[model samples]
Target: MTARRDELAAFLRAARERVRPEDVGLPALGRRRTPGLRRQEVAELAAVSIDWYVRLEQGRVGTPGSAVLDGIAAALLLSPAERVHLHLIARGEAPPQPHVPAPLSGSLRALLNGMPLLPAYVMDFRFDILACNAAASALFGPEFGHGRLSNTARMLFLEPEARETNLDWAAFSREMVGNLRVNQARHPDDPHLAELIAELRAASAEFAAWWDDQHVHERSRGTKRFRHATAGTLTVAYDMLAALDGSDQRLFVLTLADEPSERALRTLVTAHATALANAV
Candidate 1:
């Protein structure tokens, strides 16, 4: 518990130091001794007394209420996941409205396989490919066949084939980094996710740059173009539908967006079916 309190204090100091006066629409009155906002400024922004804020940062205060923590989170310009993390570390409990990532069930896999025409699959907040259908395999190639990439961020940022497969590869790569940032905040204790992130940061220069920008985004619905070896160029619209059972899983569906793409995908699917039949 003492260690936890120390961590909470350290986190608050770092978060406060990450902000600037102009960032929060505050006037730069004088030169600061630190890199970020002062303790008094943060308290003023959070509507707390300077004395109390100082005490909290010093680990001298008890667990703060949700409303007060929320105020501090806003004052610090924390992302949603960061806010959740703050609550967890500060209170030593699951954050409010916690999202726990559950493994995909058989029924969920069945649902993915049911989408024979559209490429569909389920991924957790960690961007791990849990279950993908045949059409998804036909689209993304063997990466989906291997379940999740050893590291999805590495694939997006380091794999040359991925750049060719995703037409707007650079944009998608940055978006993936942002998505991972959000997930890392949500599941701070997930060691696998942490390892994957560390590997990505060390391996991919693009990933490191985007991560340092402090931008977070989750791409829910978008159109992407893929240049398939067999199918030529196919344009598809994708959607992510969250699981109704309150799990941290989302069904990713990709549908042909135009007549040309539909024809190409149909031809590709037929060839894939014939190959599977021959193999058996």
Candidate 2:
């Protein structure tokens, strides 16, 4: 658990650097001492004693209560995922675990199979692609390649050709990165996720820049435009369906809302099925 103390310290440092004084409505006031917020300032904002907060940050104290952690999270302006991570760490509930990416079950695959008109896929908590239907394959393209498309966030940021295919590349990229940021905050000890981050940092400059923004976004309903080479412009609505077992897996489905896009979607769906059939 000594290692965990170091990890907690590192996380706190990273989180602190992410927040500028100006971000929290504090004036820059001519550069002076620290790189980020002072410890006392953080304590004041969290409504805790400086010594107690310092002890927590220093890792001298183990597993703070949820209420105290909540106060700290609020003061730090953590997103939902980050806040959860903080609580987990405070409770000593984090440790590296084996991450065997689960394949979508037969029933789930069948569900996706039945939704031939919609582009759909399943992803685990770490953003690993579990399964994608034929339409999803066509929509995301085969460069997602075959078999356990590891790390959707990495692919979106590091794959240059794939990034270009996205219509609103910048916005799409930011959202992807932001979601990963939230995930990292929540599960700092997840080795697979850490490896994904390291890989993206090594591979993509665009990812590196956006990652520094410290943005967080929850997966909710959203519209995305795709510039398909064969189908022209396609606009689709995305919905995230959570799993029942408290797992971090979600089924994401994309459906066309308008006539032109709907027609394009149909064509793409047929093309996708044909491609899949030929492969089989």
| TM-score against native, each model | 0.63, 0.62
Best by TM-score: 1
Write model 1 residue lDDT over 92-123, tens digit each, in one string.
77545534567788888888888788888788
Q: Which residue pairs show backbone clashes in model 1?
A: none
lDDT, candidate 2, 66-172, per-residue tens: 54565566556677678667756667753335456555677787987788778888887777777777777777676453543455776677666657777778887
For residue 129, give model 1's deviation from the true position in Å. 1.2
Candidate 1 Cα lDDT to native: 0.76
How far in Å is the alpha carbon of 209 misplaced in model 1?
Answer: 0.7
Q: Where does the lowest 10-residue lDDT sum fall in candidate 1?
A: 142-151
- Cα RMSDs, all models: 9.8, 9.6
Cα displacement (angstroms), candidate 1, residue 125, comes to: 1.8
